[model samples]
Target: MVDPAPAQTKLANEQVELNIPIQPLGAAISRYGNATGRDVLYDANLASGRLSSEVRGVFAPDEALNKLLVGTGLKAELITGKTFVLVPVPASQQARQTSSPEHLRYYGLIQAGITDALCDAQGAHPGRYRFTAKLWIAPDGAVVRSRRIGSTGTPRSDHEIDAALRRVQLNKAPPPGFQQPVIILIVPQGPGVTRGCDRP
Candidate 1:
């Protein structure tokens, strides 16, 4: 006699499984405070299934989220058709599921490296040079966009910066799951070198 089909087999072709990193809302706020060297307090309200992190600063939500989950294996999901932070099904429940193509997190290492090189080549003056670079990243850290911000540098310097950034590629996954447009500020330390956003 023929055996009956399993229930999992029926749903295997109809669902998707995603693994996302989650941060304690409170810890995230505190970390952001420490990173920016700001002694500010943040408030988190998770009333309607949404987590709102409010801190006094100029950081975008995605930026803040990235900072919050630093070092955590978790990743954010920013797909247009899906909601954020959804719950994952139990492993037992997924036995028959046809898993979706895995997701990826793209980073901007090469672009960052080139920017550092340009900064080194440009020597630091007595003042600051605030420039912005547009980064193009893939789902798992493959840089797709590497253009200079429109108003972040001098006409001559901007061109140079653009050229420098073109050499960068997303060589690794960013944090995880989330991919969106990001603008970064590059401050020069000396000719062909620079540092992260801290010390002048």
Candidate 2:
């Protein structure tokens, strides 16, 4: 189970502008907590023994922790804003690494099969419209189901989106309690069609 960090509510979506150097794990995390004014829970022995990489940019609290903890064979699980637990990396990895829905939109894995599914709906399926879809993934990482959040202005495209989602697979299951479904906007290739999507 994930440990709860204190002040959990307060730190939600907290971003930090960090410029820490490569140093002992404890020192880096200590400086991080001090700078961000957040509480961190970790074992002194473990934190003191490992070395952390220098993180020199803006990042979320958890993302920063992940960056700092890289190659340490450790991971930080925020139980609450003020509390974080250090767990073996294998524990988290063995459970199927989950991809946060918000992060999936930028994933380069948008396969053509999905858009190709629109072959019969209308020749307009390609280069005709952009489709945004909500993907609900199961614990095993299979996109259990999906719904069209918005349409490509055509029912045919909407159905085609659903067909395409069924073919999409996730690398791992959704995290324990992912709040929102993943949204992917698919732009059919054509004159104005682009392969990638804009940041949400």
Report lDDT (CA) for all predictions.
0.41, 0.58
For candidate 2, the lDDT comes to: 0.58
Error of 2 at 197 (Å): 50
| TM-score, candidate number 1 | 0.35
Which stretches in model 2 have alpha-carbon errors above 4 Å? 1-11, 91-200
- Candidate 1 stretches greater than 4 Å from native: 1-114, 117-128, 188-200
Q: Model 2 over residues 1-200: C-alpha lDDT tens digits?
A: 21223232335577878888766667787777766655667767765545565578998877777766654556778776556778666655633333555334424343433444444333334455665766544434555556666667767656665676676655654333332245556665666656333221
lDDT (tens digit, per residue) of candidate 1 on 1-200: 11112122212123222123233444443344333322322223321222222233445444554444332223345443211341223344333221223321122444445545554544432125666666544444555556665544467656655665665655665543332334566654567764543333
Worst 10 residues of 2 by lDDT: 1-10
For lDDT, the strongest prediction is: 2
